[model samples]
Target: METESLVETLEAAGLSPYQAEAYVALLELGTASATDVAEASSVPAPRIYDVLRTLEEREYVETYEAGSLQARAHSPSVVLDDLRSRANRLEAAAEEVERRWEQPELEAGGASIVTQFRTVIERAESFIEDAAHQILLSTTVSNLQRLAPALRDATERGVSVRVSVHTDDAETRPDPTLFEGVCVEARHRPLPAPFVALADRRRASFAHHPDSYDRYGVLVNDRTHTYVFYWFFLTTMWEPWETVYEATDPGLPTEYLDIRHLVRDLRELNWQDAPVRLRVDGYETDTGEERTVEGTVVDVRVPFASEADTGFELAGRVTVVLDADGERVSVGGWGAIVEDLEGTRLTIVDAPTVE
Candidate 1:
């Protein structure tokens, strides 16, 4: 390296500017008087003596009387060893930074904002691996491939996984075969969308596309906070998209994260007068008491629908009426208010036969 660059590097490695300059000058000089070192380096003449003294104290140089006070660069071995040690520390620090960026830990019960998109992806992979009930995701085909293994593992464990793939190009469509055994359902969205992964209604990871001017990610571990992203994924990236692939048969007993989904399926069964049983797990809306209600589903109610009506509304009130021990009880989803119970997990213990 050039003398100036070397001087700067030395300063970065824990040397004063004057000390670095004087040391470099003395190395070139072989052995020189204080006056000669100052002339060769940019260190001020008045400060050269103090700089040389400090360097000698730090063992970068040796000073002695050679007619007059003279200074010489210490053996190259000592200086080189220190520089190499600093270099090793810098390399290790760089690796640590990359590792933290790739595997950031999000705190529970709150949201974390991160600068790197990879952090969101890595966190999403971990969330998928730990998912117990459901996984909702929206991403490009390439990212789907990256997360396929995790998604497959989730499915193998009976976790419901839904994926929506989006791209800006009209002709660029993801192959339907890519989702087989990986997810329960896969949809094709004809617009560019942000990457989103919501697991079990408690954790969510969202990231803006790399092409966007402002790139960042949001990781939510709170159920209330994650609910906001769940609706975003549903309304924008999921609901309107065309289904590219869906499992031919999602055999019983099925699990649902949202009461709306459970109601949708229950509506069909109700119309057929088919007997159904469910295990509803949630907390009481008023008492805040945890309860598990398992019984036959007697009726389902929506805002503008009757028991005779089979059509379902996308928005508004949805309640599942159950008969537990011949006593009628109501179950609702997420932010349930009108219903008695705010259901979190709904498992259809016995699904009625459908041709």
Candidate 2:
């Protein structure tokens, strides 16, 4: 039974039955001539030399000569090590080819749907593995646990990973330590029914929770629907108020009610004809210089429901334009970051010139 199992294992590892039997015969015999190997194993005399020669080439056996044909089996450890190295080289080559290969444009625009829970999990894993730039995941703690390996792989590759963990009930909340060092940014938010994953803002997957046992999900590659998911994920699911970065300054206060009112009042100010004067101060991100300027508010760009195109998609980003010291300057970041800046206050200097 043991010999039979060995033969089967060797065959599964790409060795021919004749090669497997001959190699095992040599192992048992300690050393053997070609004819002796054929007698001890099932390999025909005519093919035994070829089988042994092939095994020798694969590092599974070594050839020897002592005035006649001889063969010896290498230790299994040495043979497996060689096979593992070869497999690693093949995997690296495959990755390089995939990296340089251009995918043919699909007629369906890459849109797909899977109606099985297992398939949904598989697709999500594939998306995470193929991520190049960024990955956004909004899921419950239970689902995040399933995807931990793939998420860790993406983070190790330097992909920016942002996850918003949620819960169906308060008692099932996530363990914060599970996400440590595996995500660039992570936060907790109310669970949005159904799980969502967006990769590179170009592809997305949505699926029902495994606990529901329902088998259905979507793999969206159509640019329009993918963009819709991206917008929704960034705007609603990953809202700034809900996002609490681990690296964010903890010393900063969390109260923003007063700032919100201040922003609203600033926007409501009707500087119809004349520019509204204001004071602004913040460090220049590029130069690291302390910048302070008193100038008229050229434009107050707020993230509202109805606004003209300003090249920003997420809400709550309030960009203020100012003509400071005769130079038009524009600055904006996350609402929290922008509002938290030191010495950033707006005051009416010359009110509308009395219109």
Overall lDDT per candidate, in order of appearance: 0.86, 0.66
RMSD (Å) per prediction: 4.0, 10.3
lDDT of 2 by residue, 321-355 (tens): 67778887765532223432322233344544232
Give per-residue CA lDDT, model 1, range 191-296, as digits (tens).
Answer: 8889999997799999997888878899999989998998889888876779888875567877775777787787666633777898888889999787989988
Q: Each prediction's TM-score against the native?
A: 0.78, 0.45
Least lDDT summed over 10 consecutive residues: which range in candidate 1? 305-314
Q: Highest TM-score: which candidate?
A: 1
Point out where model 2 deviates above 4 Å: 12-14, 32-35, 49-165, 170-191, 194-227, 234-321, 327-355
Candidate 1: misplaced stretches above 4 Å?
Answer: 33-39, 42-47, 76-116, 156-158, 169-171, 208-217, 247-251, 281-293, 323-329, 337-341
